[model samples]
Target: MFKKLKITCDEATTICDKNQYGEATLLEKIKLNIHFIRCKICFKYTKQNMTLTKIYKGHAKSCKELKHCLSDTDKEVLKEKLNSFKV
Candidate 1:
């Protein structure tokens, strides 16, 4: 029952966020696993956080591809036109 987990809910949350970004250490991930096993709330939060991160990552990748679809010259021309319209 989480006796060896040695992590608080806040720490679990931090670890979950770090795990999403691939920054969590193995030790941290182990601790998070223990915490999630004992804490339904933390498990739910972790699941939701993972879902949102995936959605956001997908959107970001698509946005980057869309932006690159425009050539550099087209971008420069668009930027100049936008600047001229700025009142």
Candidate 2:
């Protein structure tokens, strides 16, 4: 039953990481686009993963410039937001 699906674990991981950063190669993006067209589960998974990454990265940026700029409350909030992404 899985024969028709062309995606592999390695490809999926690469695609997931690249897609998270919006830096995937054209071919890689095309392949993922095609796969998402046919696979709702994979598509939703990828979308959520990317969204979580963006949120985490955005939160990180709030404290990235200064080594000691983040207050305890800020760190705790960022950590909480990032940890929320875990399954």
Candidate 3:
């Protein structure tokens, strides 16, 4: 029954993280899905985890396509500003 398939919140979170990395087994995923049916907090955590993963992936992909480098003058100005902030 569903009771037999239930997993603890800690285990669920671990499995959720593994699933994010494509490392979870089919049985672990099944248990996680079953756990999600009854635990709103775990469900929310999984949703947020997926959102963060997507955001990070998007940022990483975009970063590869964009290049930003400071000129020597800009670097000198930054160094002076940083020096002024020193104790």
Candidate 4:
């Protein structure tokens, strides 16, 4: 018998969050993958999550370099602007 398989948004989010760090079990990953395959929104979400994670990791690797690359004048200007907003 073919039973209905429906996953909730909260369940999908939980699965995606667990899979983010490569810590999910094989069965969990497989179930999430199946759900993703059947759900367009979940698929898009998973794709975006993967893309953002990659971007974040790449940016993290060059964070020190990125900071150093900013000109002193730019940094000073940003700091002054930020200070003006403090209550």
Q: Which stretches in model 1 have alpha-carbon errors above 4 Å?
A: 1-4, 66-87
Please provide, for model 3 over 11-49, each residue's C-alpha lDDT reduced to its tens digit, 9 standing for 90 to 100: 999999999889999999999999898899999999999
lDDT of 4 by residue, 1-87 (tens): 112345676777678877888887876676677787678898888889898889887897888565546889999999999999894
Give candidate 3's error at residue 83 in angstroms.
34
**What TM-score goes with each of the models?**
0.67, 0.57, 0.63, 0.57
Top TM-score: which candidate number? 1
Q: Which residue pairs collide, candidate 2?
A: none
User: lDDT (0-100) at residue 85 of candidate 2?
Assistant: 77
Q: Which of candidates 3 and 4 reaches a greater lDDT?
A: 3
Instruction: Kindly state the number of residue pairs that clash in model 3.
Output: 0
**lDDT for each residue of candidate 1 in 1-87, tens digit (9 for 90 to 100):** 556768999999999998999999998999998887789999999999989999999998898886437889999999999999995
Clash totals, every prediction = 0, 0, 0, 0
TM-score of 2: 0.57
Q: Which candidate leads in lDDT? A: 3
What is the C-alpha RMSD, rounded to one decimal, of candidate 3?
A: 6.1
Q: How would you order the candidates by lDDT, starting with the best?
A: 3, 1, 4, 2
- Candidates in order have lDDT scores of 0.90, 0.76, 0.93, 0.77
